[model samples]
Target: MKVGFIQFSPILGKPTQTLERLEYLIDKGKHSDILVLPELCNSGYAFNSRQQALNSSESVADSKFIRFLHEKSNKYNLYIVSGFCEKSDKDLYNSSFLVGPNEYIEVYRKSHLFLNEKDFFSPGNTDYSVYDIGICKIGMLICFDWVFPEAWRILALKGADIICHPSNIVLPDLCQKTIPGHSICNRMFIVTANRIGTEDNLTFTGSSIICDPRGNILTQASDDQEEVMISDIDLNLARDKSITSRNHIFLDRRPDKYLDIAKAIEESV
Candidate 1:
């Protein structure tokens, strides 16, 4: 099936303008099976103050914007994933959602909150989620979650053929060094959508990309530019590749030595 990734332009705290552009993308993506977007793509990252960030937050349960996402997903007969700030009575979470044609399927609150995000956002209590989308079983992580292998490893071990990561990695060399290694080691297709343009002093370079299970860059965007990439990936092939000699490195693990690692770290904390 074909998947699309949108490296959208930063709107600088304007969800209305961002939604306008996103509507355009949804209209244009009628032919794709799934459409993905970058982290904080709906409302630009506003970290100047806690009150400002809190004011920008929206509830996933009652958001009209989320309703529109469901509409678009059903209209196009596609699966949708995007990153935004989620507000609940308890706390705010940097969250991502997966909406299928039928309903909103799953939501993942980011576990690794970035520097200032820790000040305003609560870390996710649950682990990553895996879902069956058409013929593919997919997993999700948002932004900084990719820096930790445990996030992807958990999904990979859970039988995900593809891992979708919505991010805003601005550093060129850091993204260059990290992305390929993660794709190669995980032996699963990595679909990443990053953002572009200047928001609050941070300049995002939207090198959004997709990698095959073997770590080959199938499609990549130019630095600091807005673009959409669509590519056909056979989920069956990735599943088969995971067990092949070329991708066997992912399974050659020492799980016995790493029992309860996530819980152990939580206990120590």
Candidate 2:
């Protein structure tokens, strides 16, 4: 399967302009089977107040941006994963949606809110899950979720072939160094779609990348550029989790000994 991501600077508070940019990028990525965009691609990040975040948030069912995405999906015959501010049941959440040619596949809320996000957005209620996208079993995760190794591990254990990561990254080289490790540890493919340019006082790091199951960077974008990076990946590589003839990544786990790890982390939190 060919996977790709668009790395672009989104103008703050301009959904119309941002959608236009996204549409253009989508058109450019027609050859890819799956295309991903940065987190909050519709509404830019860095809201000053709760009211501003509320004003930008929209229900997925009623969102014009989502309708546009559906149309693009049908027209291009590709699966798209893009981030947006979702409003549901009078609450707002930083979310990403996976849209196919005919219908919405899944909605993944950013489970680990970063910095000021907790002030305006509710924490994700959905657990880490994978979907059968015909070509592969795909999983979705947002920006800050990358920090949690458990999140990626859960997805891998669920038999995810590819993990789509939509991020509006601001901290320097954190994602660049962290993502490959997750792919290596889990023996799964990872596609990170990160944004570029500065918003308010935050400077986005646009090193969007696609890594193979063995942790090799297949393709990556520049730190400060609007780009569309595409790479053809073999899904079979992810399905086979064996590191060597004698060891398998998943079967070799020592879960019995680390059973208290989750409880320990929860207590710390």
Go through the candidates in order and give each one's C-alpha lDDT: 0.78, 0.91
Q: Please count the clashing residue pairs in each candidate, in the order shown.
A: 0, 0
- Candidate 1 has its poorest 10 consecutive residues by lDDT at 241-250
lDDT of 2: 0.91
Per-residue alpha-carbon lDDT of candidate 1 for residues 1-269, written as tens digits (9 for 90 to 100): 88889887857567787788888877877787878888866667757876767777788877766788899999888888888778889688888888888775688888998777788889987677789875788888988887788888778888788777888776665764577777777778888888888767777777888888777888888887668788888666567634556646545677798777757566877
Residue 81, model 2: lDDT of: 94
Question: Which stretches of model 1 miss by more than 4 angstroms?
Answer: 241-251, 259-269
In Å, residue 48's CA in model 2 sits off its true spot by: 0.3
> Candidate 1 at 263: error in angstroms?
9.7
